[model samples]
Target chain A: MSRTAIWYWAARAAFGWLILLAAQVIWLVADTAGVPLSVHVTGLVATAVVAAAHVTVMPQWRYRVHRWEATPAAVFTQSGWFRQEWRIAPVSRIQTVDSERGPLEQLFRLANVTVTTASAAGPIKVGGLDRDTAQRLVAELTANAQATAGDAT
Target chain B: MSGPGGGPLSGPAETGWRRLSPRMLLVHPVQEVVRAAPALLGLLVAGTSSGGKGHLWSAAGVGLTVLFGMLRWFTTTYRISPEQVQVRRGLLNRKVLTVPRDRVRTVDVTSHVLHRVLGLARVEVGTGTSDRRHDSRLKLDALSADEAARLRVELLHRSPAGQFPGTQAPAGQSPTAQSPTAQSPATSPVSPAAETELARMRPGWVRFGPFTMSGLVTVGVIGGFVSRLVSEGNIDLDRVGPVRETWRWFSAMSLALEIATVLLALMVFVGVASTLGYVLAYGNFRLTRHAEGTLHVTRGLLTRRATTIEERRLRGVEIDEPLLLRAVRGARLSAVTTGLRSKEGGQRGGSTLLPPAPRTEAVAVAGLVLSHTPGATGGPSPVTGPDTGPLTSPLTSPLTVPLIPHGPAALRRRFTRAFGVHAPILLALLLLWVLGEPPLWPWLTAAALLPVTALLAADRYRSLGHALTSGYLVTRWGSLVRRRVVLRCDGVIGWTVERSFFQRRAGLATLTATTAAGAQSYQVRDVDLAEALRLAAAGTPGLLDPFLEPAGSASQ
Candidate 1:
């Protein structure tokens, strides 16, 4: 997996743990109001078990994250550890491409790249990259797509 | 004003020949009768129930009927001139509309069965604007067929002269003609051959038979059924039963006089309704091509409409063949043009140049109308083609290879195994349902399994083929209607590749592209990592190409 993919999962795990901790705190508060001590103990045990299960199951295949490579003829990206797969979009079929960044991405100095075609509702976004890298990638890919369109004419 | 011959030319030329359309005599009374039916019935019911105010109510009803008849008679008038056409009339507030020749788009002449018997046809001038915004510009009703034709020619001659009298240019020649090499024809009357050709192109009554009638019948039946259901709770079987009974009885009877009479009346009503629909839809249908590549179309039964489209304004063309039309080898062609708005506020009315025709005819009309070049035809063919392009490239190779410790094939096996693992859940539910003690939980769980299994199967099917070619990226993946959208590399306005939390767990990503037309954006779902980058690069080759010099690159 790419370092970015690992970071993404790590962030998810951290968020999941925060949710568990909140559940534990609510259980403790109920116990202090003299509702039930057994309830608090059961809640704590469940949270720990769930958190441990997630940590074990998620990191098993972390090596399949992919980076995109764009050429004059096509654009492609690959990801998957066990069932390796690839996607290619020829230049002629590409309708448009855009690069965007959200507030969270801005804080992390990262940007997302979105690509669109003629027949679909929403564009695909490839996120978790530095802003400059994302912009450069978008510019190059748009030029290649346009060149192919001109060739069709 | 007095003519050079010393005759007064104003005020309808003081001739009884300048009369209100005969259509007004026939239709205005019918409209009045229809509008008054409910009020008349209500008054009758009230007078019968109360037994008081009986004479007063009867007198009022007679007064209303007489008033309506007179109103219909007085509210219509039309006048024609060599230079202009004017229509003026109103019951309360007067409306006088004058349509100058320059603004008139098309003149349509049409006749109904009644009109055919009377030897009269309605001449409607469509000025390419709604009556609400523009004053009423068309003749109120039918005129003599010969007069309609004469008026059309007169308006055609007046238009160019009206706009630029000093130039003395021919009616067919425009300043913005596309071809510099082609010479314009000198001014002359519309040729006899052109008029004959138009008459030949007129849709005959025979052409409006089974298909049009069946469509009208279907709509009527469905509407009747729905309305009955809404008002009376369940459908009234009586209505359908009577229609069937009447038909059977009419056919079975060989000698019954009353049955013949009833069948004849029913047939007459059906005939009238169908003829009315045809007249309203195709009335005054006229298509004329001006010498300057502009096509004008005018049609309407009551509220006549006209449309004129310049050839240079067209952006794209769409040819549609619905299932029923396709069975009959018929097609409808329409051009998507820039800067033309349907005067109907995007609602129910617009004048189409060509009515639905045979496929070959539709194509010929399209070629004549749009002057389409060779290149615009390539996109539609590829959408239906079998050999789409290559599947992967180097940028996506790393995504296929194991980035973590386990590699990509193992992940697919895991997903496939997970799908297989869910099968027992269905069996467990079925077992509980089969037992004497019914388990509601199991049935609900099994019901949920159906969609999940279907979704997984679809995803697997989609993963089978994803590719790119030299000129375009062709992606084919849709569960309901298989769609293959080709995006030219340079055509890509913008693109995005996304992986959500669920997709991250499943090792899938989606790609989307935005194009110039705004409507033709592409969104490909659950694609492999390699395919997404290839699409992105192919969609934007200039930005993606590392070796290309900045000076040589084109700006998006």
Candidate 2:
């Protein structure tokens, strides 16, 4: 994973917290019910505290946990912070390979590569890659996938 | 012979478009009439209550339905080409759907009461993509029973060049290896070749019905309805004649007698309802192998269904033994096949090879379906053994092979998990009793649950086992719904090893084999990390080697 991934994660977390805070503010202003002012203030304070701690801690934890490797035979990825997952799908069973860059990812010049198979267990994603790395990975996967035979089922 | 349906009984190699059975015209109007009846009745009642203006609406509704129904029949036509099966439909927005003959995974022929009366059936062509949308399928609504039967055989039996010649019938058993003739009798006629019956629903098998507990759902529904009536103030048990009499009689009885009576009624009700449900769903169930590399399942009482499955698409088989069913030593066997719709497709029962029956029977049928060499028996020889050479079809029953237990770490984890979940609740209850002064008997009653949870956890641990055979990776788990899944090694597409925080601390990992078949992925939970990786390597050779790091090179 690229170092910029931390910035992207922090930005996403902060943005989410901002939306939540805005909603809380709107609810506070529109609260026609007889809720105490102290209670509303206390709720806001607690939410802000938790959100700040999360924004500070989560991205680094995720960065440490995430790892990926692509070999000729299979693509292996290790991801997730709390409950980790290790996925390995053979190139022969590779149905599709896609590289995507969301707005936040583009800001950090990072990309995500998704590898899919015919299984309903769903696709494997390797996020927080430099743009060029993502492109190269996608190209390599697509070449290998096309070289193989069978309908990936 | 030219029939009223305007198509030849058995057309040339590449037939042109053909319409549905003409008798379907009668079926359509009746179906449309039934759909419009509620509104028509409401309009008629409104006409009677008002100034009779609504009567015009009622007549117009009926007329429109009849016209629409007739138009539906006129606009629909289907044709079977050498390479593809196509259906063209729609009056205003015409659409044509085509499915390659090679992609056809299953051919289901179904006939409802009306269609049965008219000697018509519906043919559904399953083009084995995981796409569950109805629009993706090619269906001919009402074809002559003979034609439907022929279409199923024609679409499924024709082997495209270079495709697998799936599971040929034992050479001598099926005397005639030729394709079925069009003149063969239409009730999905057995080919001149001997039809091998795999399993049949016996009258004795009905005893397994109550164990299925299917009637429990009905009891819940009825209970809900009764509660709803009472809650909505629609009925008063205190005022109703039979209810008040029954309540008075019940209250007069001793508490133990009352409990026994209630238990007896519930048992009888469930027994009868489950028996009826079993009879309706699986009555005359038959699993047979046709000469043409296909397994045919014919079952159902009122709405008969015949589903044909290509043996090649079959990935494996699952033997499900729910807790109650296990208690009675009953089991259900289902085929794990690709291209077959899963539960989300509303065809969950399409892959069932055997309904609830004796566990021994289920095991035997599973063995038969999976066994490549006839008369083969005993456990499969270890493929990884030295000098074993190339893998051969197992001479052993995969289902009966003893599984490798997950060891004491998994057992300890199970107990920890059970206690972890229940201890807090127990503590909370104690706190409540001490602080809030709750009833002593209630707390004591709740404490009894602790022992049951421990037993469940122990059983769950006992159930966790996995084995890597020559042909299959068999994983067994779950106590409540104990399932032994034998998945073909070749069908495995990917591998996933997941470990939660607790599992990591315990040095345990969950290995999942992802496939395109039934349930998609089956997991062997709480195994040592090294063992998991080794299993993954053995399951799909050379797929995991490059990614594996040297000892102590990567994080443990």
Q: DockQ for each candidate? A: 0.07, 0.44
- TM-scores for every candidate against the unseen true structure: 0.40, 0.82
Instruction: Write the residue-wise lDDT of candidate 2 on B279-354 in tens digits.
Output: 8888989998765557899888877889887665677888999999999999999888888855542244788899
What tens-digit string does per-residue lDDT give for candidate 2 at A1-153?
Answer: 898899899999999999999998998999999799998899899999999999989999999888999987789899876687999998878888989999999989999999999888958899999999999999999998888655667
lDDT of model 2 at residue A6? 91
True contacts kept of 1: 0.07
lDDT of 1 by residue, B127-226 (tens): 5332454355475456655555445554544333334344333333222322332212222134422211121134554243333343456457657666
Number of the top candidate by DockQ? 2
Instruction: Score candidate 1 by lDDT.
Output: 0.50
Best by lDDT: 2
After superposing candidate 2 on the true structure, give the runs of residues whose Cα lies further than 4 Å from its correct spot.
A21-52, B1-17, B29-75, B88-98, B132-137, B160-194, B218-259, B344-347, B373-396, B423-445, B550-556
lDDT of each: 0.50, 0.78
TM accuracy, model 2: 0.82
